[model samples]
Target: MILQPDSKVLIQGITADIASTHGSRMKAYGTNIMAGVNPGSGGQIYHDIPSFDLVEQVVAEIGAIDTTLIFVPAYQALDAALEAIAAGIRQIVIISPGMPPLDMVHLLRKAEATETIIVGPNSPGIIIPGKLLLGTHPSEFYTPGSVGIVSRSSTLTYEIALELTKSGIGQSIGVSIGGDTIAGSSFLQWLQMLDEDENTSAIVLVGEPGGNSEEAAARYIAEAIDKPVIAYIAGRKAPAGRHWGHTGTLAMVVGRGEDVGTAQSKLAAFKSAKVPLAERPAQIPELVKKALK
Candidate 1:
């Protein structure tokens, strides 16, 4: 299930200094962060939330957990995620960054076997406007409305959301699916969810140079989604064969000389899909208005 306002959440590695910091902000946003998990830190209270040493313990304490926000160190992220899965926590958002790709491969395999939905290993998590805050997204930049935002960059997601708020275009949800090469979710997945969300009237896809995700999304939108989609592909001037901030944004070769992750290639995909493209963040509002028309 998609993250909702009432979804019961657990924070893995909550005793860590960084987790405590974000946990405070999450509470202020009214999130139902029911419990925190930190091995050996169980029974200790942090930010007024009870802490547990294991996911199973937390589950035994509090009923069923719907989602988990992982804040453990990169090295510990794999175990934290596996623990959540073993405890029947199907939906997880990994907030820790720099997790080794090999670790993600293992976690992703298990998640797939169990039908778990993971948001990020390095993601900012999901925010449902005024309803809930699951990760570290700054809440003030968002407003409740009819638009949906899905981005690969956390910071860009905030910037665009703020721009939308200032332009009177509020969002139904803003999701940062992480910047890693292997994310738990994809743009198409989030786009499909937004298309079915009654509160979402349109969509904004913020992509960067590198991966073929934008191209894949463009293809899916053309064939599946009926909603108007405004597209923005960053790193238009970025050089080829370099990682652009996100691990997933690194240019790579797949086969016989196909440049799938270039900005020009992704922009072309959007063009072919009949989706309107945004040259700059400031140009998005007008494009949204145009699409609605």
Candidate 2:
């Protein structure tokens, strides 16, 4: 169900400068972006991709779309996603980062009812190294290989992947589960998928200090995963009595409440689970190599 070279993609806000900029990059990367939905701009062409006023029109003209990468404004994300969902688009990747959590709540309900797969409100999306591209992941630093990467932080994902790439390791697939606290998908879900994937020989989990996601994944790895895993928690806890700052973009989604999450807590969870814990990005490949031994 992951994005592939042939997956038909629809862009919801293809006309926006942000969308067009990234959309062109995605297209250049070989994504089969079938058409775009730009409301009144139907029957026109923009960036050489066919444009439509509605999701249904695109479907009728170009046929069933397998995935939709939405570039619409945060406030309008709900409507764009719901429209795509109602029209039978099963996979939705929201590129908007500041989407209201309440809107995500409403979107998730419908997604569940329709058996849809919602990737993120703040996701950098997913990729299979050199083969497929979706959302905003920078694919240049990646090369196709046997490792699988799943993370909650987009910037951290890129950094880790770059490190892996530099060490001559390649990834089978990599995904940003979501940057928000209430993500559409979860650490456990992507972990299970990676575990089942035949292409994946090992996994890299890029976690942060927020939520129980790392703890949950740690438990799953201890009990279920057949492959080796290396984890790196990306940030530190704020100073006592201080509020979360920009250094806590990953922490912003999950609160800094005591007993909830911390770098030590998540790192300890992986240690207890018997997964290799890499304290630095440069150490991941070495740890992964040792684990695979």
Candidate 3:
């Protein structure tokens, strides 16, 4: 589900301020933004892009759509996603944050059944350096290269990407899976994709404390991934038992003596898997260079 420069994109809820602003930026970046969807705002023009009442309407009038960038309010995000799925959009990126967890569960189920790929419900989206920008990532921090990045924290993703770019280490693709507890995609899923991506020489996995996602990815990398994987787990100094912004960044009890979801636990998982761990965002480029060697 890597968004290519040629991928036709539709902006759901494009009439909204956030969506419209980013839509214009994406268009200026030379993205093939075909249309925007805004129920009653249909037949109107937003930032020079056509608006539609529904994704189906867009498809019927303009033809097939390859991907959808969702910017609807949190409450309407699920509906927009379902509508895109129903309209046969295979790839969708939900940028709105704080969506209800249960709704995401339902959306994930439907997406899985339909073989659709949903990037985030609270994400910064995906960017392929100068090629494509699907979400709200700051493109100036990125440059075309061979390092692929998958992060849970959007801010940290940008920070590390900037470090990489400044250090002359560009990226092949960078995607923020969102910091939510349950995302439509997983670290392992993206890792597998990067493993298969010939353009990606190595992968940088930016994980946050509080969630077995990093642990799970560690186990998978040890067994399945062949590419060199550099990892950095955020919230290293975060207090235990405290809930972070993302649902997945909350500590939980799983077994005796196991501080599941803690930063130490995730770090230990990476250590056990023999994956190099970056002490800080700035240290990531060095680790990436080491891995490439």
Candidate 4:
């Protein structure tokens, strides 16, 4: 998404208990201290931003939230998401993970019931530098430009964006789709939007070791779009059965030393679609530069 100046965001579950990434919190708020939510934190504040106990209370005091980044614990994630939807949050991004499948089912049901857009149950959320940031991803590494980034791993999002910045390629928008299977949105959804975005001249997709999302994305890239694309898949040699993080992190777990190489296989598929694949971090800049050409 191309970030504008008027994007308003609300941060939920901002407390001293799970509050570790104050740096991310600062980067996201930027100059617009819209609002913050924490039940017991009514009088407490972060970065000079006001805090509230409930979503409805915050909405009543500060008006409706345009978007929200949920930082509550896994147990409260579902409730937090539902509250945001009920509070009339147009866009919701859940940064917390470990949410149960049943909770996700409930959240998706609630979101669909209200037509609210959910970004993640286990994600870094979405960010547009100098505009709005939802979730915990750092904004210092990003600058607004032409390429749009969407990834399954928050860490990968930062790593890839840093490489792009070093190559002097900025992004129109960057999103972490979260690692949960029943999470929020998908790569295809973001792809369709970016394809229509005039600001986005190209796209960068970062995929992980498991699931058919990469395959699905590759298929879409092959038939419909003509814009330049670059990609890199992690877990080239991941242990067969080891569940890393994310619900979709593993497809089939076999045995020890029998790591089913996925990153290279996925990259091979992208290569068949004629998308540039970067083997190393340093290669990303060069590859993206060439692809955008």
Backbone clashes in each candidate structure, one number apiece?
0, 0, 1, 0
**Given candidate 2, what's the lDDT at residue 44?**
79
- Name the runs in model 3 displaced over 4 angstroms: 248-258
Summarize candidate 4's per-residue lDDT along 1-293 as a digit string, tens digits: 32445666677876644442552465445624477788887877676667788889978887866777788888889888888887888688788887787888888888788887788778887777656665566778988788889888888899888888877888888898888766677888888888888888888888887666787788899988677778878776666555555655444543322233256557778988888887765677787777766
Give residue 96's error in model 1 in angstroms.
Answer: 1.0
CA displacement after TM-score superposition, residue 291 of candidate 2 (Å)? 1.7
Clashes of 1: 0
Q: Tens-digit lDDT track for model 1 on 31-109?
A: 8889898888989999888998889988897889999999888898999899889999999999988888899899989
Better of 1 and 4 by TM-score: 1
Q: Which pairs in model 4 have colliding backbones?
A: none
Q: After superposition, how far is residue 163 of candidate 4 from its true place, in Å?
A: 1.1
Global lDDT for candidate 3? 0.90
By lDDT, the better pick of 3 and 4 is: 3
Q: Model 3 over residues 195-244: C-alpha lDDT tens digits?
A: 99999999999988766889999999999999999999888888877766
lDDT of 2 by residue, 1-293 (tens): 75679999999998998777777778898999888889899887878887899999989888999999988888999999999998999999888877887898999999999999988878888888887888788888898999999988888898888898999999998898777656888888888888899899999998876667788899999999889989998765545323222223334345545555666667788889988888789999898888778
Model with the higher TM-score, candidate 3 or 4: 3
Candidate 2 TM-score, true structure as reference: 0.93
Residue pairs of candidate 2 with colliding backbone atoms: none
Count of clashes in candidate 4: 0
After aligning candidate 3 to the native by TM-score, how far in Å is the CA of 199 from where it should be? 0.4
Each model's TM-score?
0.96, 0.93, 0.97, 0.88
Judged by whole-model lDDT over C-alpha atoms, candidate 4 comes out at 0.74
